[model samples]
Target chain A: MSSLVESTVQETSHAPAASVQSASLPRLGMAAPAFEAVTTHGKIRLSDFHGTWLVLFSHPADFTPVCTTEFLAFAAIAPELRKRNVELLGLSIDSTSSHIAWVRNIKEKFGIDIPFPIIADSNKEVATLYGMLMPGESKTETSRCVFVIDPVGIVRAMIYYPLTTGRNTDEILRLLDALQTTDKHKVATPANWKPGDKVIVPPPATMEDVEARLNAGYECTDWYFCKKSV
Target chain B: MACISSQGELSESARKMLAAMDASATPEDVASRTELPLFRVRAGLREMAEAGLVELNEEAYSPTQLGRSLLTP
Candidate 1:
């Protein structure tokens, strides 16, 4: 698998300059692209997280102010995510040694140990596969992007932030909670929905179903809109 | 709501503030006790308050039941 990734990277590296534009980003509901790469923790493959939810994120570079804060924030909520069986994997186009040094620096400066594997995509194989590199923004550095994959490896959600902004850790955790709740209960979450808040039931499929929903003992705003406790 | 139930869930600065704070402790008192910067203490207090672990009242911050519970084993 590593050899395959290397060959692909070599082929792309030698491609015509005109054909070297950024690849299209992966679409939701599609299988996440697989890869094997060196990480701060050692070698890892996408299949290693086959049966657990994964939060795969990319930062522009290590040792930057915004990225450092984002890493700390992510590390802060990691335990909460683990309670839901989600694992986090971070990536950037930096070397593994650099990643190790940066993680150590973060621990020293902030007194927080990052408890996740960080991929060192120096060759940009994984980044290219995930469309993490936005050439329009910076040809070398990856943009702030996140991909939430389910246990089955389906891309469930994606978020992108500009190079200048830091991400909200609360929003990321809330999104994971929302996705898990919807998957488990077959209900949709309303805007700004939190864990204990009422969830929106899917709209009925037929007139009879709608009529049944009206008397379903839930709080109904109308025939098609209803809220129920999970 | 998934309350932050343990110190591990908090950032390092927040945990420091949590350790230093007693009932009705002010941010300044926490900063002095924890030896953390004042801005960091204020930020940690805000995050703790958002997590339902602390409550702020008239320039004073106090840990809630959830906060105390987190301190316990």
Candidate 2:
């Protein structure tokens, strides 16, 4: 038991993008913009992933060193991601043939098959739709951007990295674990939290709730910062 | 209409609308899930209901077997 305080939460909407039809960067907690594009697996619509979580990521271009390493890393974790019901969709301002050539090259050389489809965004339609392009980095290439969309098509999280650095697949999986855990348990995860770790109990909204929280059996650092296992 | 081509595949908009549906959902839920405008979802649901692909129960819509055939199993 410890000192208690109360807080307030403002109701926010994550579903309004009725006027979003341009290439602007999408904000967090907003509905993901839609698009249709050609892929290594043929044409696909953003709607095609309605019931599944999607990792819509972009790299600089095919055949680039950093991007190649990323494909290998993603390939290594594709099976693990599928076990979590998350689909991987890659994008770049490159042609389908180039994607094919690069993927085939990776398979022939690195002996790893890229199980996911790579979007051939030569026209930049889908790339621009999700604002994957960073003009400051390169005019024609999409930067290393990742957008994690949930089952209902909401953009739950995004990460932007420079073209020079490859991303960490473990961190992506950890983020997915955190999001799904939060959804199921209705609690927030602490910094660097992983599976089987203590989750932060949502803070009390009133003084009475705060008082109840102290005896509520949580490991209370304070009422506002309690931890519990789901 | 444009919702169904001669090949019998659903139009992109119809597919999007249908993909957003589960056992039962309101047009508003479908709209937000697909990120399509509400008006389009309303119209699409009406059209799907007329085509026997979905059914209306008061304000909610549910996909029929025919509609389920078009989506991932």
Evaluated on chain B only, candidate 2 has a TM-score of 0.88
In the predicted model 1, the residue pairs found to clash are none
Docking quality category of candidate 2 according to DockQ thresholds: incorrect
| Interface Cα RMSD in Å, per prediction | 16.5, 9.6
Looking at candidate 2 chain A, the ten consecutive residues that score lowest on lDDT are: A1-10
Clash list (residue pairs), candidate 2: none
lDDT per residue for candidate 2 within A121-210, as digits (tens), equals 887777777777888888799989999988777788999999898999999999999999998999999999999999999999999999
| Candidate 2 chain B minimal-lDDT segment of 10 residues | B35-44
Model 1 C-alpha lDDT per residue in residues B1-73, reported as the tens digit of each score: 1123244465555567787887889877997899753434654576578778899999899999988777766
Chain A vs. true chain A, TM-score per candidate?
A: 0.90, 0.90
Q: Candidates' DockQ values?
A: 0.01, 0.07
Q: Runs in model 2 with CA error above 4 Å?
A: A1-24, B1-73
